[model samples]
Target: MERRSNKADKFKYLQPVDRAAIALMLVLIVLIGLLIWNGDRTAPRVRNFSWQNQQVGAEDTSFTLNFNRPMDHASVEANLQIDPLLPGKFSWAGRRMAYTLTAPVFYGTNYKVQLQGAKDKSKTESGKENEKLIDPFYGQFSTRDRAFVYIGVEPQEKGRLILYNVTQQKKTVLTPADMAVNDFKIYPEGRKILFSAADWLSQKPGVFEQQLYTVTTGINPLSPGKPETKPEAAGKINLVLDSKNFQNMKFDLSPDGQAIIVQRVNRNKPGEFGLWVIKPGAPPQPLENQPGGDFLITADSGAVAVAQGQGIAILPMTPKAKPLDFLAQYAKVFSFSKDGASAAMLKFNTNYTRSLFLVTNQGVQKELFKTTGSILDAQFDPRSDTLYCLITRLQKGEQDQDQEQPLLATVDLKKAKMTPILALPNQRDIQMSLSQDGLALLFDQLVTEKKLPKTGALTTNDGQAIVNSLLWLLPITPPTEGSKTQQQQPQQLPLPGFRPSWLP
Candidate 1:
């Protein structure tokens, strides 16, 4: 009886151990099932996404992207990139991500905003193993094609003006190298480009000046392996009526390519520049008796426009004839109409509060537009009835800042009314030029922050600022009345005959 009782006790003790192991197994199964269920429920999936503002090419622009769920900031930043490597910053609000980029973006260049390898944050109950997520996301978008124009600039290094064919699918350098070109004019035929380059003779170190050179499309084919050719001089480009100490420079060309206007700078005077004209292949004739500055010539007609101290004068093409007595006081001519019947002038007081006026032959100086900011640059369309001007507004409370301007505005003139077309990014030293078809604009966008003058004490004393300028082309639609709808179309042809100096 004692042996049997001992065996029974051992069996009872083993029974408790068996039950405890069974209970532990049950708990493990439950935990595994819960993990499986949560993993299936919380699998990452992408939600719908869109650009913050669909309107592309707007100045000082931003883009927003939506996501299915809150994203890990590190993951998103690791995946996001804007081509051309624009200076930008990224921020997130709720399920949306915003990116703000700096300008001057090449107007028609295809820009890709890419988001790759982004992952969502794991749920709290996803367990410790799910702490780090591996799911990724991707998105891509291109910028709009409108508001792009071609801009050209003359670099001092080689005296070569870089002409960027903004709309061309392939990059083509319109102007060749080894030329000493400064200011240029585009021919009305759109087949030729003209500019004043130091004559081959003047290219030598001791030479004082140069003459105008013409590069014809038919003459200079820009094909590979072809020998580069020099631009032929159309006629004599020299000072005809200036003090021997003054330097003569070509200013503009007539539309028919028959006449050229020249500006003579007086060496002794601080602000003295004189105007003259000569028929191509003929002798030069004086247009103004006294010092004048900033002159423009009509392409269609041989009419000459000159700006004196707050005054403007129009001279007929007749050689050695007195200028027509249509003096505009307190006004400066910016551009002339296609028919040379009207002029676009900026009227300003001593303080420089400016108003744009359309002056007609009928003695009508109508105030087409007024602005609190100063007009930096202006150009007339091929039709001459429309004017495009760049205006700048000073930023508030930032008056002491070296670069305090906040905005650049484009003003349009039509039917005696002035309208604001678009405002550009903050830039300085702005310049505007329109293509012959009026579909493109070439302008300079000042890269202000990057344009810090690299001048030493001696350089500053020499009156030279070390600033870099970038040229850009903006594509635009002609302003049509009552049509708020405008579309940017890619340019099909090279920008030819766009600059006034290139006009034949």
Candidate 2:
């Protein structure tokens, strides 16, 4: 009956090495089973989420999230929440995800977020999946604090630098009574303003005596509801530099707030224009061979883009001075991206047509749009993939033959779609700027002053023959294609000025 051939009898016939191998296999299988069970019990967690509830630059910021485990793609999207409800799209890569804001968030505003009901891709022993519920992930950051614009209101404010608080919508004048600030830029920290102004002490009619000056902007002087004392009136204005032989025409502040690039004209030798690099507490040095026109400082502060007779050349700020010719074929560069990463170049062809091209950092030119009329100005939007452009389009109506009307258009860089935002019929010297948070757009639309009978020229009320500008603050709300032009009119703030610029 073979009663002795039971389990023990079979094991006794096996070798010691075979028994050891079987035990090792059992241990490996048990370990794997434990790991699977632990994984199923633990829900995915957001290791670090960025770009939420904080002040960011006017440039469009993309949200980045890192996860501890694999997440369900659909579940994560559905569970994500942003409040006050910013519109954005999500891009996922396994445990990492990015969310790009469709429109830039308003400056100095609190933004909140919540991510709930996100489930892991794995299942548990009872066939239950782990669901992660993240509440109020990363807190917010603030954008730049305030912006400065010049107001040339005569008898009172003539080329006066006005600081407008984005959060409170408050205004404070920073220049003295007779300083006559021509052009200015806010420091990155929003504390001080570097401005070029006509020196009242050395004033000579028709002889242009401008000097560099700086005024504090970060002081809080509400003064218990005293209407906020003017910074200039508070003795905050101080002379930074008294020019002896050069006049600072246009200047750009570095994004890092370390240096300044100025387009200076030699007073002794008229028409001799050059570039000056300045660091605070140190004397400025002239950069040789730099053509004087509109200039911009690169983000790294290692180079500057100067509009020269030949074209825009990026001159490196080094001992060995060699410039890289950029966009030499274009007639003008309407604007450069914040970091000098891209530029809006205009090409004037022999056929009498002008086209606007978006030049990237890789030296690739992506033709944005072209027209037979004209492209007055084009600026890259700091926040998102958008552009604020001023163009004159020829009228196609029957009664308006050969008539062209200037219009402010917003172009979405991703879609190449242009939408008219404002009609600039008689708005001359139209200077436009976007706030650091990308939520507000400020533009000065000046109507030419009536020509004097004797002078036969338009003159500013400041006793100078210059165009007086009206400052308009437009809340950037991109409308659809079929929207009426009037619907896009921005909220016109009471601040009027020229050469409007936001703090970094």
What are the Cα lDDT values of the candidates?
Answer: 0.54, 0.67
TM-score of each: 0.52, 0.70
lDDT (Cα) of model 2: 0.67
Candidate 2 lDDT over 348-416, as tens digits, reads 777987878888888788878778778878877665677889888776666756766778887777677
Q: What C-alpha lDDT, on a 0 to 100 scale, does residue 406 get in candidate 2? A: 79
Per-residue CA lDDT of candidate 1, range 1-504, in tens?
999999988767787778789889999999889987665445444464444223233222566667666777777778776675655678888877777654333344455565656667665563453444434444444433322222233342333443333344333234444444545665533345555655333444323364555554332222122244664432223332333566666577776667777776666783765676767567676565555666677545657777766587667866556777656564567776655677778788566567877777788778777766777666666522566677776565565653435333344455566565556656554556665445566654443333333312001111333143454455666545466425453332333221212111
